[model samples]
Target: MKIANQISMKEIAKLCDVSVATVSRVINNNGRFSEETRKKVLDTIEKYQYNTNTVAKALRMKKSNTIGIIVPDISNEFFSTIVHGVESFFFEKGFSTIICNTGKSKEKEKVYLKTLDSKMVDGLICISGQEEIEASLLSRNIPIVTMDRRPKMTNNLAIIESDHSQGGYLATKHLIEKGCKNIIILTKKNRLSPDIDRMEGYKEALTEYGIPFTLQSIVETTDHPKGNFEAAREAIRQELESGRTFDGVFATNDWIALGVVKALSDFGKKVPDDVKVVGFDDITIVKYIETPLTTIRHDVEKLAEVTSKLFYQLLTEKDVLIKQKHIKIPVELIARKTT
Candidate 1:
């Protein structure tokens, strides 16, 4: 076929002696087509190199075959690992992902959610740090799945989270078993379930060991993901300046734990020998720290696997029944030099 101008699907259909819809079906590999007709369309496409506008086609079909992912921070190892897991699964399923980092800002989160909704994404995978967005998400019947922390429980919603309470207990109990008492916790002040649950677990462990829980022992830090490092450093510095004594420290995440270790080092204190430190979320780099951190491990790969599987069932299977909206993955203790 000889072409004088830029070719479109319409021109290809004309050359193939078929309707535009038939050419579209052949192009998208959807619907039924006779073998002979398929050959003709393909031949014409090859000869002219007719280009199809995917955006227009998606608009016409009302499906973009793309999933939007919203995360609090992409720089954090724990959340980034989860994103990697999501991308691996969706890549195998032939779906594209659009990742948005909110940086734990409610305004940015709302904007991203609204934009994703407007873009007509196939589904949403959210590691939501913003609590207010839950009500609006629940109002619509969307195929949305949340990971890590969630705001509220809804019947149709699917949530994937770690066993934070168990992780907290494990981390705290490990410090106590190392013969350290007067333990302090450095955690986020946010209402996110993970932080709160972890604190509760810390308390449970303390109570079990006949150690009294004191409000002064809990230090609240910035809710921003990256801000947590500095928050931990500042909190520990202030506690030390106040002459408050803490033989052990439990950090909600590895970053905060690192901060605690650093601050303690600045004050001429040795880890495990002076003040034992334990962290949650056994991020990869934790093992390489100067003093390898004793931390709690939650499998990000498993979280990604279950989340993608549940979302796929909701997206494809009409009769698929999800009996539970909230699912918790178990956590394990990884003992290292710090504890």
Candidate 2:
């Protein structure tokens, strides 16, 4: 069959000696066709190297078989694990995933959201950094599934997050049970939902034990590698210089906890002996560290799976999804050599 710059269904139908309707039915797999006729139409399509315009198909169907996922940092083990789960689930359902890394920046998040929207993604899964952007997302009326963080403004949004407050409380309580009285929570000052909830949990544990909570004990740092390490080192140095003794330490995330471990090791302090350490997220790095870290584990992969399922339900079964709001996943404490 001779091919033109633009191949139409008519040309394909003529080559197959069939009506255009038969060709259309074969192309869409709509309305039944015999195996032999379907084979002939497909053979003609392949011979002419015909490609259906997906954009037009999507316009007609009112859907694009694509979903967008936005995370704070793709390189982080927690986010990467979640992405792996989401990708696996969606790919099996014949959907493609578009990944966007916000790098913990609000502007970058906005840009990516807009870009994904422009690309006409069917749905979005956001692991948000900024709580303030929830209103903007809600206004767009796009079905959004949030992981690890929940938006403050809307109750209609679907959220999938680990029980972070319980995780913090469990971590602190474990350290205290190890005979550590003076404990400090090293975390960021930002009022992000997860941080705030974890801080509350830390304080709750202290209050239950009748231990005095002091603002001085909370060492806040920028959520970056250099800044977090500097904060950990400086906090340890300052405590030592001031003759203040701390027997237990809770770093909000594993990255900071690893830094704390390094600082303590440099200062000749033995983990779970001189001082007990506990971290969150239980990132892969913590397990293989010099002092295998005892940390709170958030089921990031499960979170992603549930989030993807919710989004799929929303896109496919709309009325049934109306009641969905917050989905709280559980956390676990993995005890290792650190504590």
Q: Pick the candidate with the highest lDDT.
A: 1
Q: What TM-score, over all chains together, does every model reach?
A: 0.80, 0.80
Residue-wise C-alpha lDDT for candidate 1, range 1-339, written one tens digit per residue: 456347887888988899999987676555688988877887766566634344435535656778889999898887888889888888888888999999888888888887776566777888957754554632235677888667565545688899899998988888889998889999877757788889999999999999999898788876444576788888899889988788999999888999999999999899989999999888889899779999999977888889988988877776578988789999999999998
> Which residue pairs collide, candidate 1?
none
Pick out the ten consecutive residues of candidate 2 with the lowest summed lDDT: 132-141
Superposed model 2: Cα runs more than 4 Å off: 1-52, 134-140, 153-156, 223-227, 322-324
- lDDT per residue (tens digit) for residues 1-339 in model 2: 355447788977888899999887665545677878877887766666435445335434557798888888888888888889888999999999999988889888888876776555777888856665544532245577787676665633688788889988999888888888899988876757887778888899999988899997687765455766676666666676777778999998887787788778878888879989998888877888778999999877778778888888876775654565787788988999988
Clashing pairs in 2: none
| lDDT (0 to 1) per candidate | 0.81, 0.78
